[model samples]
Target: MPRRLISSGSTFEREIGYSRAVVDGEWIFVSGTTGFDYGKMTISDDLLEQAEQCFRNIQAALTEAGGNLEDIVRVTYILPDAGDFPKCWPIFRKYLGDVRPAAMMISAGLSDPRMRIEIQVTARRSSGS
Candidate 1:
């Protein structure tokens, strides 16, 4: 199967020779997407807004792979401050609720200090191999 490159204007992807996501057959791998608009890395301090942007970024990549949020089977959330879980979890659950894709959360440093959260995801397209 020919692999299709996914780009959301993420700086890391352009700087490191990588893609925001890769689509091969039915599988989609979304690189760690930070909380920012496409092509911009610097983010605001609001944890909830940042989380929402991260999810949106992942969704955009998934869509490019001929998939959607409903197709996501797994997700990994990385947060710089775990304490913000309370504020961020609600938004996450609100968006991914019934889909109930497998998820993991880890608190760690981000590439940019201003970024508080990053999300990586996996999805399978219905028509995909």
Candidate 2:
């Protein structure tokens, strides 16, 4: 099967030498995505807002890969502040409550100080989906 690459048109993808997501057959591997609104090249200061944006970015990449949030089988969350993780539960549930994919969170520094959270996901497209 042929592999496919997806891009969000974020400058970071080109500058850092990475695609937003890679599709290998039915599997899609999304890169660690932050809250930046790629169209405006801007990010929010609020953690919740940033968290929401992260999903939006991830959703966009998945859509381009011919999958949706429900296809996500695994997800990884990275945050600069561990304390902020709990604050994002509602937002997470709002997006993935029903799907409830496997998930993990880690505390670590991000490339940009402005970035509070980063989300990466792995999705598999169901046959005929």
Candidate 3:
């Protein structure tokens, strides 16, 4: 199948030469999504709220590619501070539940210091995806 590009209206996606999400065949690869919502660059101070928005952004991208949270096969979470993991993990779990896909967490300074969490996801439309 020809690759399908998903844009978020975020100019950076075009400026940096990448789409918010890329779909190849039945697989969808969502880029590392930041806390910024839509075209807004403002980052929120509340980590929990920021995390929620992150997932929401992923959801919209996945839906555009013929998938949803249930289709997520793996996820990578990058956090500037591991200490905030405890506070935000439960909120992530509430969204992922037992169907939790493969996930990995790493501590690294994000592009923006105000960014507490960033997530990238891969999903597929397999019979079991």
Candidate 4:
């Protein structure tokens, strides 16, 4: 199969020259998605809300790339404040506890101060499972 690029219609994607997700063969790689609702381009100040929105954005990209959260093999979480990460656990567990993909969390600076959380994931389509 040929490589495919997926877009979430975020203006930043066009301005930054990157795809929201990329599909190649059986693998799908979703970019680091923030809490911003792309349609409204707004983010929440609460960490839990932001975390939920991040997963929603990632799910949208994964769905467009021909897979779902169950297919995810790895996940990377970026948070500007390390202290805020624990507060997001309940929300994270809601979406990923069952799937339990390999995950890592890092404290880092974000492009936007309002962005409390960003998530990126990689998935592989199962064959005959």
**TM-scores, each model vs. reference:** 0.91, 0.97, 0.92, 0.96
**Candidate 3 at residue 25, lDDT?**
95
Q: After superposition, how far is residue 34 of candidate 4 from its true place, in Å?
A: 0.2
| Candidate 2 runs further than 4 Å off | none
After TM-score superposition, the amount by which residue 63's alpha carbon in candidate 3 deviates from its true location, in angstroms, is 0.7
| Clash list (residue pairs), candidate 1 | none
Candidate 4 residue lDDT tens string, 1-129: 999999999999999999999999999999999999999998888888888888899888888887888899999999999998888889888998999999999999999999988999999978632
lDDT per residue for candidate 1 within 1-129, as digits (tens), equals 799998887667778899989998888998888888875566767888888888888888888788888888898988888987677878888879988999999999987788888888888887542
Local accuracy of candidate 3 as per-residue lDDT tens digits, 65-110: 8888889889988999888888988878987877689999988999
Candidate 1 overall lDDT versus native: 0.84
Whole-model lDDT values for every prediction: 0.84, 0.95, 0.87, 0.91
Tell me how many clashing residue pairs each candidate has: 0, 0, 0, 0
Error of 3 at 101 (Å): 0.3
How many Å off is the CA of 126 in candidate 4? Answer: 1.9
Residue 20 in candidate 4, Cα distance off native in Å = 0.3
Kindly report which residue pairs in candidate 2 clash with one another.
none
Please tell me which model should have the higher TM-score, number 1 or number 2: 2
- Candidates sorted by TM-score, best first: 2, 4, 3, 1
lDDT: which is higher, 2 or 3? Answer: 2
How far out, in Å, is residue 94 in model 1? 1.8
